[model samples]
Target: MPDPTQPRKDTRGNILFFFGVLILLLLAYHLAKELEILYVSALFAVVLMPVLHRITSWSIRGYHPSRAIAIVLLLLAAALGLILFFTIGLPPVLNDLRGFMTDLPGRIPGAVDRLKHIPLADKLGVETIASRAENTAAALGSYIFTSLPDWLTHVFDILTTIFLCIYFMLEGEHAYEFFLSLFRPPARQRLDATLRKAELKMSKWLLGQGLLMLTLGVCSLTAFGILHVRYFVLLGVLMGLFNIIPVAGGVITIAMAAGVAAIDSWQKMFGVLIFYLIYVNLENAILTPRIMRSSVNLMGLTVLVALLLGTALGGIVGALVAVPTAALISVLLEEYAVQRPSQS
Candidate 1:
């Protein structure tokens, strides 16, 4: 109690500063949560800049492209990509679907016969396997049908992300400079360098990812075609597209492919499985390491951790940008903590 006589130390300054910092942190976290779309747009813009830069450097019939012309050409390229996807990927899938529906009734009796052969199935007094399968199928159908609305929202979000990305690509320089202006000169310079490094790495991922997809697509296509598998083109393209999703995607697509193969015969199914087993091992041992070394340059554990953290922080969008974000954080830590370059 006697300490009160020693000039009551005004704690206002320290209290105010602490509260200010807390407010800033809370604001940053809230903004991150609310503006995920904007962040994702910025990420896509960075990844696509290399492609845009290359396109901008091209000439139209020996005439240099103006900014508008470059934009036109970029849009055209996007259109071409969509056109190819619909033409090459969608038709075979549709054909397979139609054929499956047409043949499903005829295939039912055979499926039932096979199920009836299951040992002890009758001894346990179980219902027909066909009935069990039908019930499972009905439940799955009900779930899917119920989720259509959510899927539509997801598709809308994707389209919006694309639109935002294009807008950012077209006119992001001003905004970028505005962001840089928030920091001091030295801090801004370091930030610019770190961001540039991140951009380059992300661009490399775009190229490497495309290469991996193409490799898988071609290999799967050729192998499935040789095996006379139904929906070979469809399955191949699906495998390629699914690779963007990492671990679970490949497994899901391969399982679907195997299911389709089983419709022909267990021999074809086993052959397909064997091929994928060898291919996955080869990819893990040889393909991914060689191709990604110059690109992402991340260890397997780093990637896994990045993905987990990103997913936790940003959901699907976070997972999408995880590797590049990790790369950016690594660059910052290196520049500041490891290198400690002399400040000018």
Candidate 2:
């Protein structure tokens, strides 16, 4: 009984709607790319805000907000300068990296040959093990040097990021307040609480994780130095930085260390493995739990979901921020859905 014209109009409307959505999505993507520096700066500012706040407060008795903010900006600038200095000075480090890579494959087989003579290798096979070692070394070399252009791009990106971070540190509070003022008083209060919770969680996570990484790097460098490992400083720093990756960080650290050690000698390779095993257990049992306690306590499933969603949205940066954002969302949802109902 429906008119044919009505159906035709409906189809047209649907097509228009679909196209509109597509256009909007494309626009959003473009805007995000254009403002990438701003977003990254904002993220860094948020992470470091608590440190700035504390320093500001301590120096200026009754929370002289402006002075506190200025101090934070200064600290941020100093940190960025240091990072830039090191990044520029990294050619020698790269040369050492190249040396390590070239030497690794030859060193690994000798170590594997030593392993073949071991009691455990008597039960397993020697040729099979040697083949596996070769394959692993090849894969590692490929992984290390496959994307030179991408590395250069990332380095350039870091300079822009530093500038953005300074800008955000300076203007963050005003921007936050402006956004917060958009809602009704009660809604604003709720929003403020949510923001505070997220900021606190993120700040604690950043500070604690930063300290943890520094400690881990120091420990790794010292241990590797004692073991006479090649490129110990470089490897230690890489491991420490990558340790932020969640769950798989420790495994990757051990794998990289082991691969490098395999190039040195069998005894060194064995020593690296043993060191990692002990280190990992110690980290898990002592350090991680302590560091992570103040941060958002996300479920494993939530973390995986966040990671996937983040990667889909923004690659590495997305993956880095996704877990914390998801945790904040969970907290907000719980506050509204469960807590509010109980209160009523």
Candidate 3:
């Protein structure tokens, strides 16, 4: 008979469990690092699951769509959107851009002349800017030409991700089932429930983010209008679009706004900076936490670290999926790793 106080050992099972955990970590890291296109595609598929399910289930002319037909319809809708954008949106933007470029040379000297009157402009070598501008423009042009190959590579990766997303959307249910099969029946039930929770949270995030983007865009447009900022519409549009990427997005928009403002006057530039500073603080402190309430439960530090790690792993796509990925990881950790108080 075994002693009542003695603990039972399961050495072989423990060793196997350790190895399984190690392998999973290695596999996750490898996917995040090397095969980010597929990784992001999978994440995209998860996010689009609700939409796909709805579309597939909905009847048009008394006919429900097959998975392939649903996938094709989604792709076609996306293609239609691009076609509309090119036909409707691109011309006006191109015209404005062409007008801006035509006026740029004349505007530069005026800007430089105005800069000469500014405080400490002499000390800052403002006079040298005009001389350097031409060389700088040439260098920028050369850099853009040289970077074409890299740009094309990026485009290729985006196309591959899109293609993979289509496939994932079609067979995502099967893939999800296969994932569930990796565990015992009880474990599968738990995991299935956890993933559903994550999916709901991610869906909420999509809605919340869209609302935030719209609000920010409207605010940007109003602020720029009040300040009589040039290219206000384009800048506002950019602000809204970039705001999708979280922290890094704000920085890029701020820089662009500041540069555009500087072209007119330092006072306008300062005003733009002040507006952004106030807006960023307000959004971060108020809007973001409230809007992203579901994700806020993950803690600020975890989200920041996730963004950093994801960016390090796979650039923009990683960053795009970072918050959801972190949320999913948090769900797993809470379900398994975290110990809870037992009710008496």
Candidate 4:
């Protein structure tokens, strides 16, 4: 009645606008899916950036950075090769693992018997404790054997990650520049600041983490060797690698070590547990504070939140990236808040 043709045009425009938004959202989702690989690759580069920087700088004095990087890669390959060789070829290591699993249930009652003779058993119900420990060991053994196949499948993913990491190391700078050029000047400046903050945070976190792992591994290996634990080297290496994960990793490593030690003697099992507890405390109180304070200044609550969110989104890899990503977000948001007030 008022203007039928004008109403029709308005409806058409609305429909087109909604459709365009839908298309854009679909494109964005697809891009995000593809970006997972790129994100992982970038993380690897960030972890290695400190080493890369040192190598590149040294190379500017006549040595080739490419060659230096190649050497570093070669060394890494050799280390991995050695680990594989030991894990595969060493009969004692295999035998120890098999024996530990097969005898764990039997060992628990023996430990309880020994515990009953101790002074504290009369004060606390030792029999109940022993029963629980035995049940837990059996459950753990069953879980490990059940999950082994799935764990093996993850090896393929590891290989893919390694390849992507190598590619990123080779092409990271060029890729960064290309990405920056895609944005307008103001946006590019903001993006560059975000990237730098993230990169620095990630690099420092990873390097500090690596050093912490090395320290813990060495200390653990020394303790094991002193106790004459079977497959000390293998156990140490496993602990070191798993230590990359934050809270859960130490617990898992200690539990496994204790279970394995139980096959020998309860005294040894208890010793391993005590040692790990002490080491974890030392790491948390001394080493982590000293190393990570400058890099990741987030409070414990923030870290926990980031970890939970990361685990929800992408599993272990996501968890690894979550802290730095949150830190970057925090930095950008703070900057934006300050700048907005000034602009107003």
- Please list the C-alpha lDDT of all candidates, in the order they appear: 0.77, 0.75, 0.78, 0.77
State candidate 2's TM-score: 0.74
lDDT tens per residue, model 4, 1-344: 58769989999999999999999989878786446666776787777766766656665558666634764765587689888767874665567667666776787777677667888786798788878877886788679889999899878767777677777777778888999999999999988987788778777887887798889778988898888776676687668777776676777887888866765787888899989989978888999899987787878788778888987888888887777777777777766655665587
> Model 1 over residues 5-41: C-alpha lDDT tens digits?
4453557666788999999989888787447888788
lDDT of 2 by residue, 120-160 (tens): 78678777877787778667777766776678887767788
Q: lDDT tens string, model 3, 1-344?
A: 97754443566678889999999999988665446777788877777777777889998899998878877888899899899979986676566555555555556677788878878988988768876874565465457668989898778778888888888887778888998999999989998998888777776676677788888888887898799888777777778888877777878997988877888888889988999989888987998788897463768788789889978866786787787888888888888788888722
* C-alpha root-mean-square deviation, each candidate: 5.3, 5.9, 4.7, 5.4
TM-scores for every predicted model = 0.77, 0.74, 0.77, 0.73
Where model 3 places Cα greater than 4 Å from the true spot, the runs are 1-34, 57-63, 92-138, 218-226, 274-290
Where is model 2 poorest over a 10-residue stretch in terms of lDDT?
Answer: 59-68
Q: For candidate 3, which ten residues in a row score worst on lDDT?
A: 3-12
| Candidate number achieving the greatest lDDT relative to the actual structure | 3
- Candidate with the larger TM-score of 1 and 2: 1
10 residues in a row with least lDDT, candidate 4 = 66-75
Tell me how many residue pairs clash in candidate 2. Answer: 0
Clash count for each candidate, listed in order shown: 0, 0, 0, 0
Residue runs of model 4 more than 4 Å from their true location after superposition: 1-35, 59-61, 67-93, 112-152, 229-231, 258-270, 337-344
lDDT of 2: 0.75
